[model samples]
Target chain A: MKPTTSDADENSPDLLLFRYVEGDLDAAQVQELEARLASDAALRDELAFWKESFAEPEAYDTAHLEKSLLVPVEPRWTGSYFGTWIFILTLTVTLFRPVPVAMETRPVLIPAPVSTPAVADVVTEARNPEEAITRSRMTRITLPFREKRLPETIEVERNVNESIIPAPIPGIKSRPPEVLSPVAQLPLTGIKVQKVKPKPKPIAVARTLSRRQGRAIMRMKEKARQQRKADQFLKGNVPYVVPLNSENF
Target chain B: MRTFLKAGLVWSGILLSFACYGQVIPLGALPMQYNPAFAGEAGGPRFNFNLGLLTASRFRHNEYNLNTSYDQFIPAIRSGVGFSAGYFTSSFPYSSSSEGYKFSVAVAPKFSLKGKYTISPSLDLTYGSSATSWNPRPGTAKPLNLSGYHLLSRAAVLINSRKWYIGYSVDIPLHNTYQYYRYRLFGRSDISPERFNSYWQFGYTFQRSSESKFSFTPQLVFLTGTDRYNRYSRNSFRYFAPEAFSLNFRYGKFIWGANNAGFHLGMQTERVRVMVSNGFGRRGLVTSDGLGSDAYTGNLSFRYMLKQSRW
Candidate 1:
């Protein structure tokens, strides 16, 4: 719908004045109309109606007064200027929202090297009764540990926010991505936070080997068992952005 | 630090006073009317330094106000002091001369309507003495030694998104002089409004960002003005009335595309300047020695402009 002047105020003086304001008109009718505004009471009343239409908006019809001001005049929510206004408001709020830029600093994930045999992709199938109960217990215990450590790991990470490394400082060279866990959290400690060492996965050799060889395999098994014990040992939950800052690499 | 800070304040005040002097002419007393909300409040005193030569773009911020420019950044209107020096070379029809070491008092105010259009009016009150030597030297004419000031007060309006603008600009002659050859007056100063000619301009900002500075503005400007200027020669006779055309280019702070009249080329920072541009008037269907030669000038400046910053 086209918004025109008189449609808003049928007796507006500003509207009346706008048309005659420009150009030289020799029309006798225009001359008579100008002369009439001075003497006629009804014309004065009508002109007063025009002036007060905007000036004394509380005295007039709300709809007509609103139309005159040319404000948020559109009615529907989905279409028209109202929609545009909503979009602008939403965009402004969204753009200015504090973006907690720390999210951009995801710790450079130097993923732990997995034992080739231990990490085989498993297919989902109906499980044996004994295995199912054990697996359910394992998941219940493991899930909480994973969820709890995430935040702690993230907080300790240093270079997680930036994606690309900055231009190499001319005098300085870059080293490969490495984790630097806290010195206090060495292997001798019972702490079980995962480390990201690039050790090859241990292969299951037959147990017929000598005691020295068995001890190596046993040590790997010993470490895995210690991890499980610590997993159960953790009492509270914390999400982590773990890196060299939090653990051994 | 205290002495440097004081100098900076004094310098900024000088530039600000000169800037307001220029703005007051066009706006008529709006720059100083204190707002009740800001009556006792003091805001953004900034200090920025630019390496004055090309290939040295390392700029330091807030040297004068102790890093106040970033956190205490002002909007449109800012108060601060700066010192700049630059050189310019002018090439006139008869000969070419190089004018160096220009100093300026700068002011910039940007006004805007929310989410729509932005208006920035800035002034540069500059004084530069000349180093000029005429070519085919005129007879008994004292060397056109223009040892005075050049003031350029400009108002610019820009759109927030559409990149369109309409501006009203007036270049007022300050405490300056020109050994204007009769022919050069028509070629130098256009007929100004209020005895100073005005140029109504329309422009489009095609390229923009931090590094671009003035390099980003590609404007189509129309210049029209007149003064009684006569170019009578033993070889040819020419008269100056009013010349008008749409000049298109990227203009830096001081220079527009090459001109000889007063415009010289001095590069401090930024691009597309009308350097003390000498030899830049394109002759219309008329000829001197029947040679349609327009001396296009390009000057390099010593004073570098700070980045086109948002205060």
Candidate 2:
């Protein structure tokens, strides 16, 4: 049926009729809708049809409806055993492959050692005895002896006069001159000469120090030992002493 | 319908071209793989499997990788385990080519915060072996065989919301020993051990969801790490060091399908500088004449969700 007003308009008579039936219109609009409904047979018929159609439907069998609307689902690849096996096999093969060895050639270089010349002034002065006695200022000799070992003896030749020989000093042990090719008498001057005992292999000795130096070295060694013991105890490597209980014992 | 067919044809052509160009390996870890907190944040029990092929510009071969994960959300806990496997071949112009394979497993647990935010932390353990066949030299009768096994580990954290995510991760080497076997003399020699190295990554992801057809994710990644060395006797070779600043940008698209299944296509570009220590303390890039190099990668991923009723 043709309507009096366009359906697109919100204020159309058709919408007003529905609102009137729903009791949503105000008093004046309801009165106007009622007057229009009374005048128009088509409006009365549309309203009656609308009321019938909008009424609640009768009971129906939902069991059949439920069965007809099921959604189709495809099986997933991950659901299969073969897919799982493929993943496992891939992981196993990738992690267990054989490793390779690397090789390369590299050059090695070795360095040479350097040499120094020996000093000659000390060797020449020891050979002249007349000059040595004139310059005798109690020179001391210090041998390089290993721990607890006796120092080797060295012999020095002298003129027959005993006073000409240097006196022995403390901590510097000196051996008596041994006569090699027994004392030779000079024909005119009546002077006696003795051969040095091959210079006693020419022992290499350093300059000497006093007896207090030896005592200082011993004290330093004792201090170092005590420090080592204290360190060991602090490091828990040695047991520390604890006071024992006593009754004025 | 004609437009749809044309788009399909174009995508197929692009895929064919990419396949011919070999694989493009992602230089850094993906957010889902590195972050535990991002697990199962999509609001369902889901399974994901992805396969990727990566090729680098400096290397002539392709690398193939496969990853799978399954996660479920419960009132009490959110947990998932992931497995990944990869095989790669690398060739140098003047040196012998090498092939390697690796397998990794990750365990991730997620904790929900305030029903909107999630925190996931994960640990990954990986093992792999590689072999290099030496080139024949004038004095050598046969090629020397060089092989090695390596173990790697990663610890990561991710904090994510429905639309954004932030994550950090550290990847380190656990075992760095290699062995060399001389075939002619039947002698074996051990190479210098590799030193501890850590590769770190900080990333942010932004997601834009679509109602029906497509979704998009844009990500920014910052990568940095210290120098790593391989020691032989008293000499050491520095292999890789982090650049002062490096960044990666990734754009990903998701095309939806029936029953929550979708195809994910992503493209990423990265520029990084690696300090490589040659013998005698010299350091530079092996791939580039300059100090840094650029890498481009593409990824295609697929996911299928089995709904509760179907399960």
Candidate 3:
């Protein structure tokens, strides 16, 4: 039989190899191509490169092709190494990090009582029983509380003669005593009393003043007291108070 | 039997680590969930629609996702533009049910590396919202609804050849906020939490055939976040650091034609950890140490594409 080199002679070596692998060449052409492939080093390398680079088209029909070709190559350095290191570092830092547990320090404020002149003016302006009650409510006394354990004794100072008394009868307009003595007095330990100007007339004589004038005087006294307290608190000199239980005493 | 035993051991270790770690937010049907650069790299169809079903083993959760993507290559700039919209719903056996929707747009510009590889860089902006329903406590008959919005920005790089591709991406949370009605014994009030989250991922894809190809992709992702709970309440200022590591595998097939169909299967495992600190804005409280949970999930999806051009 004549050697059928006619088809193989027209094609390049690469094409010839592809045709041979695809089973498109006749028997004589296949033999011729195989002989050349065996003798040619470059041709062998080219064929090997193609085989490694491309898969047969028929292989696409098989689902298992990925098992051979598509499986990801093992990385030289796996991500798990870095991940584990990070995980360890994070856990260590979070678990061992220092945290503060104590309460923060805050400034405390204590307001001083109203001045003697202001108190006298407020008392004189109260004209009737109703006016006295209203004016008393307007006088604000702020006690600064501290977040600490309280002591047995709380030091509160007062004038011994200036006692809290109910308003006199509406029609009794006599000039009452400037200072009414307290019915009972707690024992004074280190209390200090500073002498000042005399107080105004008591609630009985103040009842003769007009109600509108009493209201105006009451508002002025309240505003002055609030301004003084705010200034003292801002200066950080206000006294701090601790709540005391009567049983502790 | 030896292979089975080895696999079993590996899975057990993963589960143990995950259980001891923190909570993980699931990535439903977004390819950007793996790497943002994958946005328009395939470049086959003008419109693609996908539907997926997923199940998680940790909380006995079932989830469904529907997504639609549109991608077009602009010859003038040698770039691609992609837009994707997705909806996701998840239900847990006894805990909560959540529904969310997301929309994102990406611009990808392509460059050739040494004429042998194609490199594409992409930026994606995403907006999403989620609502969760929590079962009523002991005395209440109505469920509580919590809703939140998230804005995310992502940058990614992808390098590809005919047979293989590799990508890396970073996602940053631009804004995240959540609000819910919190009921107390005496009254009900609104609570809004401030959230910050970011993550980075690296992925590799290998293809088996030239035409009608089958591919496998594996991804490694790292996530970190600081989530502040009950931000507006006094004596309730608490913040936690959440960190997670995830491994994901995907197998997909692409059928080439005017009307193309794609099928995918995915498996994922994650370990999360949360470290909580109390009294961030108050006094006399310390940070609390906490543990996390492990989760495993599987997903199956199908995609149909309508091609408008042969590019």
lDDT leader: 3
Count of clashing residue pairs in every prediction: 61, 15, 11
Error of 1 at B295 (Å): 7.7
Candidates' TM-scores?
A: 0.27, 0.37, 0.34
Worst-scoring 10-residue span by lDDT in model 2 chain A:
A240-249
The per-model lDDT (C-alpha) reads 0.33, 0.44, 0.47
The deviation in Å at residue B34 for candidate 3 is 3.4
**Chain B, per-candidate TM-score:** 0.40, 0.58, 0.55
Which RMSD does model 3 reach against the true structure?
60.9
Model 1 Cα lDDT, one tens digit per residue, A1-249: 423564757445545543344323348746765887777778767656544432111122334655787677456666667779988888666555443333222233232322222222221222254353233223221111211112222234454344443577787765544554566234343334688889786797545878877767666774565344334323212111000000000
Kindly provide the TM-score obtained by chain B of candidate 1 when compared with the true chain B. Answer: 0.40
lDDT of 1 by residue, B88-176 (tens): 33233334344445554544443333323334444445555544454346555655543434443333222222344454444555544
What is the C-alpha lDDT profile of model 3 across A14-94, one tens digit per residue?
667766655779999989988998999999897786455432111121224447768787755558877888899896665
Residue B233 Cα positional deviation in candidate 1, in Å, after optimal superposition: 17
Q: Model 3 compared with the native: what TM-score?
A: 0.34
RMSD of each: 45.3, 63.5, 60.9
